[model samples]
Target: MIRAAAKNHKDVLVVVDSQDYPRLLEFLQGNQDDQEFRMMLAWKAFQHSGLYDCAVSEWLWKQPTVGGEYPLSFAVPLSLKSSLRYGENPHQTAAVYVDKRLSEVNAGGIASAIQHHGKEMSFNNYLDADAAWNCVRDFNNPTCVIVKHTNPCGVASRDDIIEAYRLAVKADPVSAFLGYTASTIVDPVGGVGGIWLIWDPTQVSVSAHIANSQLIQATVKRENFKEWVLAAVYASPNPGIRQNLWNDLENTSSLMVRPWLIAGTILPIS
Candidate 1:
């Protein structure tokens, strides 16, 4: 019937067989001669058949049981919401989706995050943010988490937000450079190397002096000086982490403030 329709120059063909539907569609979609596509179709068919066989076996196994003991079946539905800017790297494509079942029960997952500012997030950002957010969320006290490559390089919990951040950074200052910090408060002081700060901006405030002084006397006294002082701030709903503390110096100059937020959590107020 399909060949007959094609012989007659039909514009489209509708295939109804579950077993051949995917392959037919793939063939019509210009993958007719692709070996990879053929292999993928075969694998998918095998998986589908295997699942059906498993279901039948499960049913048969339950039929012989006297006490009606059977394995429970579970299904999770997911919906794609948007595509990420990129995967771990720029060459890879990525997307974000939400589990319908889980989203109903939990309110704090990545799918619920709100971006206040900044450029589109990458796959690594979501991964790193999730790691940092989960770590800080587990701590009740003011905490700071500096994540480098999906691992926490520095983490500290303290009553003082600034002190917690300092202690976290002090844990592994070198690794903390260009790392992501998740905490309840963050300060945008200079001297501390580049870092991505993520926290709840509503719970933090900038000091008048520290906010005014971008470069302080202590930063100048440092032997190894970097041209750029601080990196970006992300305002999230998670706990806030503090930034570096600026020394009270008469000759300190005010820092240029940039307002940016990493989507989901962590934000810097200008």
Candidate 2:
């Protein structure tokens, strides 16, 4: 109706119920002319087109509703969990939500993943699954990725998923069991309260140790993080000291370090 009025180069009056007139008037307000009317019509048309295309089309894998709220329906109620990391930084909050109906239907009525069992999910768990599950989906062989925050602490692929899980867990066992295993300094003994282990049934362990674990997150995504292992550590020494040492090393590129420097290096020393 708005388009028709705009095309005729006339004032567009959208008359609905008296109660809706206030809402309608809120949509259009400006010093008016045919040009302005046409522009308004075009903008409205574009928005409507985008809504139908992105929000209502068959290609929409995820749905976004008005006011950013996904309505809960009997057919598709959502299950949610809060994440450990805030947004992209240490302070920003985040969470994950899945449609319980779709999950149950797709997984053959098996509620294999129970998020309420123990520890809450974290941003890194979602991120880790984003990296690991895709890898699990791609190959007949099993694969695993230990992620610290969004980066891979350790990743490996093996015929047996359990072996892969062992390799992933061993990468930085002290940190691996914690939420941000590779990035955070987890208490060596105390913080092992809950560790989320996401895996297929073949890789699932039933031992008391595995049962005592805090959380085990499991999912399937294509193209896993089996080969993208981050180095053991990402810390850098003082830049000035490092640069000077680098310059000295470059000048004596072939020089071998004495036993003292090597011996002085901490292994047993902190």
Candidate 3:
């Protein structure tokens, strides 16, 4: 992520996915209203430039550890993705930025995720989410990963998806307060589980959310559950992700079936 050449002004229109060509054309034809889509495109345009600028800085940072002198001035330009209520504390200010390079190469990850439902994510939320996302991807079987404060509170991979999730939380029920869950098994088959039956990973889940304290539990509803075989049940920890309880789940859940993308949520220590 290197220059602000792709920056978007107030009057500009930006679209990255070619699949949106039909939608863009339709929007131009005045067939519908997509104010939210317009805003998101403008945001992506700025991120394009931010990625370029950050690319330059990323190169500079690498030099120091590679026997080269550090740059006289150093800076990283990241496009703001979301703003946290606070940083590590209430008095501090913090926000999350999208990695333009990562977005360009692959548009699925914690940073570029689509939030199905959740409260405003905190900085620590991002950290723990990142941890959970990576841990689940580490397996190729029906798996579940539970994370707390950026640590692997629990992780299990089993032939049975429900059992996997149960074992993960049971690994540390006290710390099993999951804000999100993930896995990478394609053709992830399923039988009757506790709440629902999920037979295929490709079908769209009819989410019948059972919202907990701060999270909306995933309870996929279908007129014919046996036919669709699509189900997803999300859960969360105590109450601030331990306080907020249930929050943030879409990223890892949506990414579960996308096999092309193996791993990308390695947040920088800085």
Candidate 4:
């Protein structure tokens, strides 16, 4: 009716907000050409209608047949989580909504995540990140799950979480770089390029530890800084210290390379 009156070039008075009662009375007295006031009311009317329609649709979706999927009359009310910059595409306006009950106690899910850094997450990012989180959480060991378009591109669980991540990235490097990655265990021993060396501190001791803006290296040793096995590498993105990082890696590799064999009783973790 509001659009029809506007199209017909007639004076239209839309009432969607009770606060506008004063304005409506003023317009009734002598202001009929109040296009701005009418337009504002029209906008509110449309937004309210859209939300009501969404609620009705959700309620109807819950209705089930005698033996069909949906069960009975009920409502599934969702509260907004956030307004996204864009939805599945730029053309659509979108917001993420969550079930408040689930979100309240969600300790580690994406819905309850507190981002430490990075640009605003998109709708698709939430979907893919949630997928990666779900998959990675299922494993007890160190695991990496890479999800693209809400599907797993790479997933690996290993005795070594770093090795698991390496295998996952090797499984599909291009996709791994583009998609969301969720890792269950990241070795606290930091290294270069956001990389980490994951090791069992109970089985070995740290002989020497090294860290630069670009990398971190730790020499794994026997009982008390004795002979060792191998060195772990993590490279940072800082190009300012490339030469220093390379020299350190080379020196460590050349000086620490040694052949070691292991033969031991194996007990598997469930």
Highest TM-score: give the candidate number: 3
Stretch of 10 with least lDDT, candidate 2? 260-269
Give the poorly placed runs of model 1, Cα more than 4 Å off.
1-73, 100-108, 178-270
**lDDT ranking, best first:** 4, 3, 1, 2
Clashes of 4: 9
Q: Could you tell me the lDDT of residue 154 within candidate 3?
A: 84
Pairs of residues at least 3 apart in sequence or in different chains that clash in candidate 4: 64-70, 192-215, 192-216, 192-234, 192-235, 192-236, 193-235, 193-236, 214-236
1-270 per-residue lDDT for model 2 (tens digits): 534543454445433225545545655664444455445555555444444454444334344443334433213334453345445444468766664546646651222245555445556555666665555556566788776666667777898888998887877665575423221121111122223333233433222111111111122232442221111111123453334433543443254332111101111211
- TM for every model, in the order presented, reads 0.40, 0.31, 0.41, 0.39
lDDT of each residue in 91-183, candidate 1, tens digit only: 689988875556567764766577888657778888988889888889999999988888998999999999999899889967775333432
| lDDT of all predictions | 0.53, 0.43, 0.55, 0.61
lDDT of 3 by residue, 1-270 (tens): 112323433345677657778877888899666767777666666665656676777675677565355556655555678888567755578998875657788754787877787557767777888888888887899888887778897899999999998888888877653322332111111211122222223443434233333222343433555322122332222222332321234444554442221211211222
Instruction: Compare candidates 3 and 4 on TM-score and give the better one.
Output: 3
Q: Sorted on TM-score, highest at the top, how do the candidates line up?
A: 3, 1, 4, 2
In candidate 4, position 147 carries an lDDT of: 74
Runs in model 2 with CA error above 4 Å? Answer: 1-86, 99-113, 169-270
The worst-scoring run of ten residues by lDDT in candidate 1 lies at 213-222
Q: State the weakest 10-residue window (summed lDDT) of model 3.
A: 184-193
Residue 7 lDDT, candidate 3, scale 0-100: 44
